[model samples]
Target: MTAPGRIGIDMVPFTRVRALLGGGLLAGRMLSADERRLLLDGDEPDVPGIAGRLAAKEAVFKLFHATGETVPWQGIEILRAESGAPWVRLSGRAAALARGAGIGSVSVSITHDEPCAVAVALTAPDSEERSAP
Candidate 1:
């Protein structure tokens, strides 16, 4: 069996995200092109969706445990599978952090309500760890 993985959860208020996204720069900095497309393709009133994505990113960031490092927001790309499930793609420093932490695949789940959004991230142990039995 695989080793138990790390879990991270975060919640974000829609209004807060809305204000950040209003400047547009934060959205560009935080989201990948595909993620931005997904946000735009979503239904009207995009604040909740943005908040959901932001929360997902924050949740994934927590899994890294990079205490003194700056959050590589763009490196942790949160995307959707064909089945509409949330998946994580790590790159750059985020990938390095995951490797350092023995994190393999990262999965995320996001939900939105009127006022806020919440997300949870789970990081699977690396293959070597899984094979260590």
Candidate 2:
């Protein structure tokens, strides 16, 4: 049987992230390789994008936490589809935890305006095979 969906939301300020990015290494530490590439390839002043992704990651983390799971910062990767839609991919401890929790997939939505960014994540059950009656 499918369980009720769980949602998590997070918001962050670009100014805070911009200050953290000033350290240079913080971005590499927080973002995956592909995410870094995308950020670099984008237009200048990527603070909003960075903040949005950070919020996305936080939202996913909160979702897992709500389900009594603790995933590492790098264990959850947020990537954009070719169409520019945000999505979540889990790996390492995060993936193992999700599997144990019966979480099949997660959907993410991200939005940003000058000073702030926000993200929402929704968790759903994996589709299960049914037997013929």
If scored against the real structure, what TM-score would every candidate get? 0.84, 0.82
Give the clash count for each candidate: 0, 0
TM-score of predicted model 2? 0.82
* Residue 28 alpha-carbon offset, candidate 1, angstroms: 2.6
Q: Scored by Cα lDDT, where does model 2 land?
A: 0.74
lDDT tens digits, residue span 31-108, model 2: 778777868566664788888888988887776654545446677778777677877778788777656656677778
List where candidate 1 sits over 4 angstroms from the true fold.
1-3, 41-45, 127-133
Q: Which lDDT tens digits does candidate 1 get at residues 15-72?
A: 8877776787655688777777877655653777778888998898898787998778
Best by TM-score: 1
Lowest lDDT 10-residue stretch of candidate 1: 124-133
Weakest lDDT window of 10 consecutive positions for candidate 2: 124-133
Clashes of 1: 0
Top lDDT prediction, candidate number: 1
